[model samples]
Target: MTADLPLRKIIHIDMDAFYAAVEQRDNPAYRGKPVVVGGRPDSRGVVATCSYEARKFGIRSAMASSQAYRLCPQAIFVKPRFEVYRDVSAAIRRIFSDYTELFEPLSLDEAYLDVTVVSRCRGSATLIAKEIKDKIRQQTGLTASTGVSYNKFLAKIASDLDKPDGLCLITPEQGPGFVERLPVGKFHGIGKATEKKMHELDIRSGLDLKRWPLSLLVQHFGKAGQHYYDIARGIDHRPVRNFRPSKSVGVEITYPEDLAEPNLILQQLIDLMGKALARLTAKQMTAHTLTVKIKYHDFVQITRSKTLPQAITGVEGFEAILADLLKDTEVGVKKVRLLGIALSSLHSPELLHYRQTDLFAFSMPSHFPN
Candidate 1:
């Protein structure tokens, strides 16, 4: 089925250690040194991103800040300046606009561009990618890695093949063989748990996955099995969408001191929910589901959720629901270190008014506002 479709030229661009690079570029002293961005070493926060120098010392994003400190004691820890990063990201998007309007931004640091019909650089996807990389460097004083391929899946994989200012191309002729030799864990959507499950099933690489019958793969992995089956053959038909909507709005806080009092915990939840409601309102959307999460001091975590028939517009609308959800958890009986509230099943009121069933779609990263 995929063979009959026309080949599309896709390019994936990823900034190298984006946050840490921005910090280094802004501060000359931090250049060539290991820089960790996110939280202070003594705090309970985790590393958001780090410089390449820090990667050599076994530091990585999402590692505990204290653990990162233990790995590289000399690594400099700094808080993320999102405002500055957003500005730089906007500038990079402008550069993308010059090449093609079919670009889809995956995050502030990376995007997928469909330049299949673009005539820039004599319609060479590789040259277009190179020009975009050069423009980003000239404008932002930062480096980006680009991967060019016939599909999004392979292009994204190719982008990560080389790092810290590198460019790589994977042609249609090389896609199948390239995927065959790759490890199952290296596939983008295959995480640790799924990779382990695949290993237990004797599916250790792309070749192994390709050998599984569709019926057997679906029996084990359900709907995602089809994706695995397709990508193993170097096939992905998904297009690059320019406008992606926000899937959910959520906020969480990790307190410096654990809360054992029910009243205090309730107050904190209210405060967090208020922030999330404000974000929903800002986006002109309402949610039908509300969830409350609690992480106890010993790291036992639990969540309770409710789906309402009507959209939730404000915190007052769900105050009772929040209390009911909290009661279901052992919040007062346990020492709570984190409290989070998330609103999902979101829809735009304007769209709902017209009875549009297809809700707006976007990506919202989970935020830890502690």
Candidate 2:
């Protein structure tokens, strides 16, 4: 099906150690040193990002700050300055706009750009990628790695082939062989759990995945099996949408000390919900579902959720739902390490009014984590 569509000239650009790099660029003292950005080493916070120097010491994002400290005792830990990062990201996007409007931002640090129709640089995606990288370096004083390919899947993969300040081009002729030789674990969107499942099925690489029949793959992996089949053949039909809608908004916090009391847990959830609601409102969106997540100190996790008959317009709409969702969990009986609230099935009230359609029939899970 994907083969019938015209080939796209896509480029994926990812900033190298974005948060840490911004910190280093702003503070001269942090240059050439192992820098960790996030919570303090003594706090229950996780590493948001770390410098390449810290990565050599086996430090990684999402690792416990204490563990990161243990790995690199000399690592300089600092809090994230999100406002500065957002400002830099806006600047980066302005650069992207100069080349093509068909760019989809995956995050503040990365994006997919479809330059198939762009006439700049003689329509050479490779040259455009190089120019983008150079412009980013010149504008932000930070390095970006870029990958140019005929599709988003290959483009994204190519971007990661080299690091820090790399520019890789994967031609149409090389795409299939590249996928065939690639490890399934290295494929985008295949998480560790999915990779483990694929390995147990003897699907160690793209070649092995390609050998499986689509029906059998579907039986094992459901709808995602089709995606695996397509990507294994170096085919991805997904477009680079410039105006992607918000699917969900949420916030979570990991506490320094576990809370055993129900009231304390509820209070923490209320605070998180408040933040999530504020984000939703800021986006001019409302949600029809509320989900509460609790993680025990032992890493055991459980979630409780409720769907309303109408859109949730304000905090008062979901405050009672929070307590109700908590009742379904072991919040009072278990010592909680993390608390989260997610508002899903989001819809812009103005859009709903314009379409004059009911939004209660749909529900989607929130993808963002605090």
Candidate 3:
């Protein structure tokens, strides 16, 4: 794995408060106020993004906007300007392309770039990150946090260590000790339920986590346990893969806590479906398979999926299909820690049915909005 490691300098860059920041930048009056970009609290909505000002009041993205309002009543909320954000992302991407072709965009707000042989940005990865942040702020009027490290895992985690215009670096020579001092929950792959399970096992930090045998971890958490073992040692070999001719397209996240409420969990699924659909449409592709993953409190994970008769690209339709699939509580109430949805068997956009066959009859008219 070490031999295959990317010798090229890889950097992860994530925009701070993407949607909210854009709103604040475009609308000068929204500055310094708690700005939320998502649906309203009155309509069973959650925050998609919020400004750092709002964060001071403990408001965060992916949380109920009502909760944000309760936390910071002075916050200004706005609907998502996805098109504007995409245009901005395109502009930022054009900057990265100036450096190298080996760019992998993780999201509209974040990307992984390999500047190995390229030297256009001056100095090393650290310097490049600083320049990139400056350029993004100068051109797009948005602050970005950056991570410079050998692998994707370290780069991603390092970027989050300091946020809202942060730049963090982790060298390969720094190695396992860096991870050892890391909190049990702070390890890249270890999330809420896994951390709790590790705590039960008397493994409360990265150092404490290392005491356990790798074989034992495999026995407990299955494949993920092996991943933990590797990451704890600062060894993540997963390469940055582009979505070139993809077999599948999907999005998912591991929550900070186990979701005990079924309704709340369903909402998470809807959100994931929305993101996956965005990716699908952006890529101009369709799917013939749908997979829903549930990671239980006990660290056991099960994925339920279905292969449709025809390729599907409709975001609302895909969500409906997922809701239908999830109607049966066969997985039971296990206090899920992670829920993800993915579509597979991808085909070209032309090969798939992407048009409105019956536009007026559709329940989600906005799905094909001009």
Full ranking by lDDT: 1, 2, 3
Against the reference, the lDDT scores of all candidates come to: 0.77, 0.77, 0.71
**Best-fitting candidate, measured by TM-score?**
3
Q: In model 3, where do residues sit more than 4 Å from their true spots?
A: 1-8, 252-270, 281-340, 348-370
lDDT of 3 by residue, 4-66 (tens): 544545678878888888999999999998898776777556677788898999987778767
TM-score of each: 0.75, 0.77, 0.78
Off by over 4 Å in 2: 1-3, 250-291, 294-328, 331-370
After TM-score superposition, what is the CA distance of residue 52 in candidate 1 from its true location, in Å? Answer: 0.5
lDDT of 1: 0.77
What's the best-to-worst order under TM-score?
3, 2, 1
- Give the higher-TM-score candidate: 1 or 3: 3
Error of 3 at 253 (Å): 6.0
Clashing pairs in 2: none
- Candidate 3 accuracy as lDDT: 0.71
1-370, model 1: which lDDT tens digit per residue?
Answer: 2656777777888899988999999999999999998667765556778999999999986566778999999999987766677677767767776666675655567778877777767677777777777778899999998788888898888889999787888877789999999999999989776999999999999999999999999999999989999999999999987655778888777765677878667756765676566556544578999989899999899989999998886656565677888888887788998889999998876753421111111111111000
